[model samples]
Target: VCPEDSNDSSRFMDLWYTFVDPYATEVDEMGTDEANKSVGVLRIKDGRKIIDAYEWKHDNDVHLLAQNDELIIYELHVGDFHEKFKDLTTKIEHFKSLGINASNINSYFFF
Candidate 1:
């Protein structure tokens, strides 16, 4: 549903039905048993296929930036930040509430 190629329509539909749909049921069925988990497979019309599937759990304590050490040193774009947050003051407040340290905000710099 996220604007994939029209050539792989059937594959996309299968992916949506297999993985996206009944996500809760799949997660519940899998539970804490990693070995018993059913991995979703995607088969393209061109014969290329992918088997790995990932689920993002909503954990408020886990920050996206803190997930990987590589992300810590990376600088985020100002325009993207503004577009994502909408308001500067509210964004700053949110960051503070999330225990993010104050850093110099450079909004004028373009990538």
Candidate 2:
């Protein structure tokens, strides 16, 4: 359990809970309910059913170029361009030849 000071209720209003159930396909929610009002994360692991706390992990491996203005941006819609990242990876050489250093992709790129 987290220290009371660390889990300060006043600062964190949204109670995040992870429901892990191998047989469950969707979360149950009613907009008015307290659980529904907060965040509910669905998790699939080994083989279990329970509620767990959610933690955020920041990506420290990403390196951005110092010169942002020099970046060559390419807007792409994953769904429209290609269904999956594997298909997009196949065109990496093409993008490199076109000088596309960065891309703005749809939020559902992994979907």
> Which number leads on lDDT?
2
Cα error of candidate 2 at position 10, Å: 24
lDDT of 2 at 108: 67
The digit string of per-residue lDDT tens for model 1 on 29-92 reads 4434554455533345567544336666676665444444333232344565655535655566
lDDT of prediction 2: 0.66
Which number leads on TM-score? 2
Give the per-residue lDDT digits (tens) of candidate 2, residues 9-93. 4554556765444555445563585645533446557776555555557666787763787889878876665578788778878
- How many clashes (backbone N, Cα, C below 3 Å) per candidate? 0, 0
The root-mean-square deviation over C-alpha atoms between each candidate and the true structure, in angstroms, is 17.1, 13.1
